[model samples]
Target: MSHAIGAPLIWWVSDYTLANESALIVGDDFGSIAKVKLESETGLKDIEIIQQNNQQLSVRLPATISYHSHALRLYQPDLKTFERVWLNAPKIDWLQGDMGVKTSTGQGWLQLSGKNVDTLNLQDAFLINKTGKSYSLSLKESDPWHAVFNLPKQIPVGSYQLKFGQKVTQPTIPPLEVFIVNQPTDFQQRVLNIKDFHQSEDSIDHTIAFKTALADLATHGGGTLYLPAGHYRLSNSLFIPKNTQILGDGNLATHLIWSKIDKQESIALINLEDNTRLQGFSMYHDDAAFGINSPSDRVINNVHIEDIVIRMSAYRGHPTSEMLTKIYDQILKRFSNKLDTIRLQANNITLKNNDIYGTGRSFAFIDSHGINIQNNKFYNGRRGWYSFSGCSEIIFRNNTITGADLMASGGGINTLGNKVSSRNLYFANNTLGMFNGWDREAFTSDGGGASYFGHVQSHKENQLLLATNLRSKGLRLTPYEGAVLFVVDGKGVGQYAKVISMSENLVHLDRKLDVALDNSSKIIICPLQENYIIVNNTISDAAIGIQLYGTGLNHVVYGNTSIRTGGINLLGLWYGGYQSAWYTLVAHNALYGSANTRKFNPTRTDLHTSNITVEARPRSTDELNLVYGIVIRNNQLYQNNGVSIIGSQNARKNMDAIFVDPLDN
Candidate 1:
């Protein structure tokens, strides 16, 4: 031994692939140990040591190896070379697409993939960005575990990060950026005519000739800027980059206006990005603004708002006047007290046939992903609110919400997932309250109607083991894999699965669990919400007409129809997590009630007393809050208070929790 002065501390190694061809190593002192070598990149070679002592060694593997990890050394007994170490080391994971990559023809290669990406090292790969600026990367194809490279035709939009040599990776979820674009060989030069950059109905201002026709159509790379039958005006706010569009001519002949509501300027008088498009405009705006916003943090993918018409031209008065309720109480006292006449955070969005009228609050798709509000109308608003947070594939169809709130807080839709947890929703055929004359009544004080709220992350199921895989977000999430593994409340509540792969706190699932989850179950894995399909919607004077708070699993609520609302509300509450609701169905539907009915006939006043509720409110006592396997059948209640299921174990803990008799008889 050399009495420890320099090298001799390996501290663990192992990973000689080709099915573990032996490597071991370990660490500490180690006195007598001759020769070893390895080095890689086609240099040093001598291998076989096979065994040793004073700590550990093993070795023997060189059958053929050039890169993907090497460096070892060792030698002692007087041949110099003290220790070294290094093995395997190189792991990228995912990056897909390359070799002349065609992000719809902008081109920019990438590939990468995982495990020893052919040992990386194209001068230590690069990419960096967010100000530090790097670039490098070229290697076009190397594969004992993938690698394609190239990226850097122009690279300049935003966010980057990759590095590889000194390692610097973590930070995913729609960021990347990297650009290339060059198209435009005259397809009418991709149409840009804003009257060839001037002269719209000449109210002048035209914001510098519409930002110089959107920078001359972004240097001939993006398209369509049209805007024919105009009235224009705009004092600011425009942006609209990426594959741009912005057409107009019908939304009552294209009238913009927007003078920046007295420069309160909270942004978005347009904004958008990523394959953007804002059709047939008519944006009017007089106070609480927004009109068309997107990119509240990134993930701005394919957006398209068709036939738009966002109103609010400073209280035209009389929609049940009081000077339009003091202009909706001074537009809810501004300074950002929430206002969204379309404020989506894009991800394949498509809001169609829009109308979004008066006062304020109309749409607000936050943390979005695949949303499609179709045939919209949203009338005389103060709260015809259609807010959805942390969204996921949704389709609020045939929309028509008339009046949601003239005063007191109430909207017409909600989807609480705020940070993440909202799944495939398809609220169908929507119609909601007080038609045309618009006076106020689509009510919804969060979960009293049209509420969806979900996202629960284990409130029990004490380490469940229904045949393996149930690890949890102790890592807070990074390996969502496929996400979705419900079992909302009590022993396997309604059972659900699908996640087939995840680590950093395990999750496995693709199958298993027909019913077997202990500690009074209650779970939720991804950004929650499961297959939802509130069908045939038509609610009337709402105060409750469709709520599935804490949703999960197959939700159906079929053929809906409530008239004097307070009808379909299956709430398995949640305050600090433990949210519940599973396998719901609520059938037939025709419930018409609204005379103050009381939980199910406290001697009704006529109808509408919580028409069809399934409340399972548990906050503590070891949490569970269940609503398992719900079914509420055939419905037709007129004077209300029919299918109630509050709390459970066969209802009525002083009236309400389990009645379960939906007329199969």
Candidate 2:
């Protein structure tokens, strides 16, 4: 008989038998008892198997099992059956512990003592609410005995019970409570009352009192500095210390207006450090008021800015005709002013439920991680979100953006790979409006990671000479020595060659093409990245809904609706790093293109008629293969051009299909 590995041998015992410690219910149909043994430190020790029934049998043990680890083996002599079972008797030293205030995307730790605790698999654990709703727990990081779980962002704010194990009868360990407030429970104990400093709304220079209060708070460890309902003027920037919070009455009640007597070119109204919170206040800046400024080198974490309103351009008095013209040009043409309301370079930050008006750039994150920007409203801003310099795991969700006059730059959300790579970035369920500039997109990335091939001029000696189309003029190509270049169109379209060297418009290959190319051939470099999901978003009155440049891997663009905008545009993948956008799925997007607009005018390209339009223009024997492992299906395109291709095969008239590795299917 073949022995099965890693299979659990089930042995069920009743509560009465468990207490009596005589009979054990094996739940098997064996008629006679043969042999029983228990695994010990030295080896297996034989135990007598007395009095047997179909469901129950008695085992003679040296002592009471108690709460100890045991492994038992059973053998049936008549049928020659053998089985092994591992049992863990668990004991809880403590039943309840505080899990702290659970905010959305917050983390907390709980320590519990129990026998055989190391065998617990936290992956199967969940938190059950009183309303019978269960939220799955994700183990962010863990040690051998302790683990921290992240609270789900969408979980309802309520009390919940943390549960472990897969069995239905498993009991909850402790009760966890989630609060809607962002401040700590003991926040009131550390508040510095502004009234004690004799600062009033009529004071033109509250800088002395405000600075003194902040210094006093920092001297005795950081705490909350409360500002009452008043319009206080500050001539200089207010620097916030670590582990400090600046609280106010409310956005409409508390106001901090910048009244700098001497004209300064740029001014940051508030500067923050690590673990800082700014809430329930309003700020008014004249020319351009910087909201929060945190430098890159600081170890800033858990910086929460919520329930605040920031109004830039407040000192500009009234909008001039030239400003209005510029705004109109930006609204209609996609031009931007490039001013940021908040400049941040930090990690583990959350900006939620705030109102921002009249800014060039609303929020900017540079080389940061664990950033959450949600439930915020932006009005009259040139850009809503700008992330660059290798930011990862950034989420922009459920934000409403309108009246962005960015001129010819920026968009609702822009991710640029200026110095490093941006990975695991997600944008979900956002409402976007008009942008400035003719070439502006609702969501755009420039120099992302991939490059495109212009045309194949000639093929000889296993090398393909190509003309540069959208290749960067000063692009250094030596780093892509071993990268794969595939033909995206023409004869032998799916064929690929290894890149040897690239100089300006010329590309040298390391392999000969299986077939020659023509003027219709286009090629792409393939060095794919990972984990980009864009789902369930709505874009209206924009030039382009979403435009992806360079190379992206394992990405999904699904369930989006575009009105009066170009639905999705996937441009070239060429950045001299030999990266291609592969393993992508573009599905179920409703895109409406206007006929009067230009074909590429950020307008939808009738996927129903044209599907994906591949413009591969290659000339020589080298083929053009730009994309791979792409699935474009179930899309309801308004117009079908009958000329688009899906993967290596021509798309059928309205057929659902799959495109993947042929051998895997």
Candidate 3:
């Protein structure tokens, strides 16, 4: 076959091996070819030309291949052509068996057994340092689900991760890391000591020393920064960088005291980064407000904090009306308080086995996801433990809160939802109470909550036309994709649909409306809260144990006990004159009071709903306050208000509270 005056034409190949496999490359006009090469980012290598049959070239691949979508370059005198191919044939899920980086000898090698390792070509494989320097590898053994590669001897001694395939941009399965040392005995001394950076024992300021140690460790990759049994004073906040850990001898032995000279400004004494940890230490802050924080700007992944104690010595007194106003302002803007002891705005965080005592809100999480906070104790002097707007997949379990003020706005595991919405939250196996003598009755207004704006205009097949325009606050182009729309009153009651997209005054739903709705029907669009589980918890001396206020749906409150508490109260609360809730299950609980469903007024003085509103307070309107699809079953109500319905609002018109199997035991 003769080719035109372009370049050497490539027809096809028998096998495009990413590994060491013999293959035949058949094409036209191969007589004038001088060199055939396989090129990747690492470098280039010449392919061995075994023989030629007509227009075919028989070749053998390199023994150790490291390529990803590389091009095969066929070179001739002033005539060249390229053919690109993807080399990733295997799926590397996880590793097992002897995946060690160090061999018996002084040299370094990787021998591992993993899923689908045999089909891989070791494409783009490297051992990366913390400073982002990569070293190449040479493969040795190739077997089913097993691999062996020799590491370069010139690679420096440090901590490194064995990374493969494409560079990761999001949080996913992490690559394996290993410590490279000269000998096995050096492994015990791998931890960097914080005292080594200090020049003199007389130095009261350890900030410079701490920063110097962190920079030094980051230069040679990352490792743990150890603090021995001693007290250190820091004038500035310590920002623990990514892929690092700051550990102490023990929580009782090692202490970090924040002596803030600036009294007015509030800043976190410790700021955490992605892939970072702070453990085995006791932190004390007196002058400044915040204890530890993860800022929202920095996208974090997989942070673990354990065996630590955060104590605020200068406790701010009970929150006044002015302080509450400031909190409401922040909430309306979907922000958190600056004075929270531990304010986290990151994802995939595990905070456990710690004791936190704060003057204001002990814990405040905003716009975060996948947070697991368990086995912890919180002591609050003012507000309480709050998980605010835009948080989801949160598990708050096996924890206890004491001395909570249970303020009218919120207290004790509060989930305050807003436009971004809170979803997939859980509170289980926890204890919540106030330490002071039970002077104030426990109420639902003091517990969990969710709220948002609502107004109904017209309803179509799969859309809800709204009266309120969402184009304000720069939300014109922003679609309310994950929000929920519920027909809470009148014709289409008990049916809800998820928002697929939204225009200025229109909402597209996931499915068509099952029940026909008219102008008299009251529909609510909740961008506040959804899909929560509050179960297996113990509460005492609270006016309301668990409350789902305002707009929420598909929430489960089961297997909880209330001792002197007001019991589980679900309120279809009016925020900015509208509210709705549906598909809530409150079952198998023991309470001192009756389990109640009510339509509450936020503006009433006794209602205590002013906690969440600043300027945009809840106003009494003609629109319906609605709660439907409520199931209260097998609950032991000690009082006569068992499964009682309060308020003669529109919720009583078509309120669906299904009582089953002995309404009250």
Q: Number of clashes in every candidate structure?
A: 7, 46, 7
Best by TM-score: 3
> What are the per-residue Cα lDDT tens digits for candidate 3 across 1-665?
23346344443343224355444454445666667787655677888766653345555567787432334666665635443322223333222211112221225555543323454546456778899998876777654334667778787877777777653321123577656655322212347888888878688888888988888766755678999999988887777766678888889999998777343333678877766778899998764367888865765665778999988844345768887666456543433333577888777667899998865667777767667688999776543444455666565678887765543123533334434366665567888775332223222321222222445677778877766676653343344577666665565445567778777777788988655567666666656466566777887655456766666566667678876555566666555435566555566677764222132345654422211100111234344436544545556666443555554433224343332224133
Global CA lDDT of candidate 2, please?
Answer: 0.56
Kindly indicate the candidate among 1 and 3 with the higher TM-score: 3
Per-model TM-score, in order, reads 0.32, 0.58, 0.60
Better of 1 and 2 by TM-score: 2
Compare candidates 1 and 2 on lDDT and give the better one: 1
Ranking according to lDDT, highest score first: 3, 1, 2
| Ten contiguous residues minimizing lDDT sum, candidate 3 | 608-617
Which 10-residue span in candidate 1 carries the lowest summed lDDT? Answer: 97-106
Between prediction 1 and prediction 3, the one with superior lDDT is: 3
lDDT of 1 by residue, 1-665 (tens): 33346455553343323322445564444446788887655678887776666545666556676445666678787867567665655544334332112121124555543334465464567666667878776787664434667766766644556665542221112233433344422324488778777765544878778889888788877788888896888777787767878888879998988666434454557777777778887887666566777767676777778898877645553456777666557766752436676777766577788887755566677767656667988764554455676565565678887664443223533344335355556566788765222222343313211111133333223222332223332233443444556654444344566555555434556665534456455455544555565677787765566766654545566677887766777665554444556555566678765633223455545544646777776544433435554545456776635776556444322111122333320
C-alpha displacement of 491 in model 3, angstroms? Answer: 4.5
For model 3, name the residue pairs that clash: 442-542, 442-543, 442-544, 443-542, 443-543, 443-544, 444-544
